[model samples]
Target: MKGYFQKKKMIEEIDKRIIRELQGDIPLEKSPFAVIAGRIGISEEELLKRAKSYLDKGYMRKFGAILLHREAGFKANGMGVWDVPAGDVQRVGEIMASFSEVSHCYERPSFADWPYNLFTMIHSESEDGCHEIAERISRATGIKRYKLLFSTKEFKKTSMEYF
Candidate 1:
């Protein structure tokens, strides 16, 4: 099967190198991109320009930071899944995504055994906090048929390396 990137515009060698550098751990410095550009033998301005170009051309969907929630006192991680009606999925998903506690929210295909169509990744300081956030989301959306699956252990959490 063809991957998503296989259908997108082909990138140059420099772009591949830039993506490789970007996929790795960015330096904890004042000018991280500058450091990356320096290593890649490109000016910081050019790096930013190309990155913005990628966004504009839909080569990249978004550029965002990966938060280390565990070290940041987010001890509880919950996956809140909702059985939303097909007609109301969009509206309810928007409401669920509005919650500050919710980090990620998206619609997924529902199965016969598992009827949840909406899923939200919630982070909190405690398990009770997660429950409270879920309850708030439920009240806001008025969708009571939901489940909060807490994470007991995280085996892996990493961004995809395109290059």
Candidate 2:
């Protein structure tokens, strides 16, 4: 713990220790930062600064809640797939990407049975809402042969801690 007093850069040992604490799920309490700080033998501010630095440096992606889509009253989320021609793929993908309801959009390898090359996820509070979004995109893009695969049943939606 000599480095604790020195304000030096994080060495391998300290870095490993910090990683160990982070790998485990943080204690549940009114003041979680205090719990973590106490366990790490550091001030809450220092721990927060280190965490913020990690987030700022892109070492940590987004830190937020991952709620179950079903519990949140989202009845259906459709994968709106499009078979846009190569010339309009980029344009249509960009347009599809602009919708706030569309959480993710990507290009996937097409199959003989499923000819869709591009896919956009439309998550909505209701099935009708999701369908509306899909229909709107279909009308906007002028692509008729798209598929809407909704969530039939959630087999798995669990959150795990990464240490």
Candidate 3:
């Protein structure tokens, strides 16, 4: 029940601070790293090196935006869960991720009620597009059982500040 990123190398206090600073809007400046480095009491080169090292050592996933789907012209942010067999999870995940609309894909533990082990996010321009993605994924993976949980209400959305 643990995660993969627990054992990371060269992750220090400064690196944690750097991650915290990047959680929100990146400062608008000539040298973002330089500004961030100054605030975190580290050299820009050191900050950049640690960040790159984290990526190289698989400590951090791709760092980017937490976009507002509706504002970004994506009318639906559907959570597509699939009952991909254990042996086929990797291939099926890759196939799902290959779709133009799928934003993310990963494996998760399955429950009795929720037999889905593979999960993916499909942000589409419309509900029809999301359905199309679901249909294509079903055909591609040959897994007939899956569910598309679309967001009916904007309840809570925010970025987690990793400090």
Best by TM-score: 1
lDDT of 3 by residue, 1-163 (tens): 4444444344566666777876657677788889888888888898888878778866677666667767888877789989988999888888888887787899999988989999899878888888888998899889999999988887877767675
Model 2 is weakest, by summed lDDT over 10 consecutive residues, at 2-11
Candidate No. with top lDDT: 1
Q: Which rank order by TM-score, best down to worst? A: 1, 3, 2
- Per-structure clash totals for the candidates: 0, 1, 0
lDDT of 2 by residue, 51-142 (tens): 78767866566555556777888767898888888788888998899988898999888877878899998999888898889888888878
**Residue 147 of model 1: what lDDT?**
96
Error of 1 at 132 (Å): 0.7
Worst 10 residues of 3 by lDDT: 1-10
Off by over 4 Å in 1: 1-10, 29-31, 55-65
Model 2 off-target regions past 4 Å? 1-30, 40-42, 160-163
TM-scores, in order shown?
A: 0.84, 0.72, 0.80
Candidate 1 residue lDDT tens string, 69-150 = 8888999999999999999998998888888889899999999999999999998999999999999999999999999999
Instruction: Please state every model's RMSD to the true fold in angstroms.
Output: 2.6, 6.8, 2.8
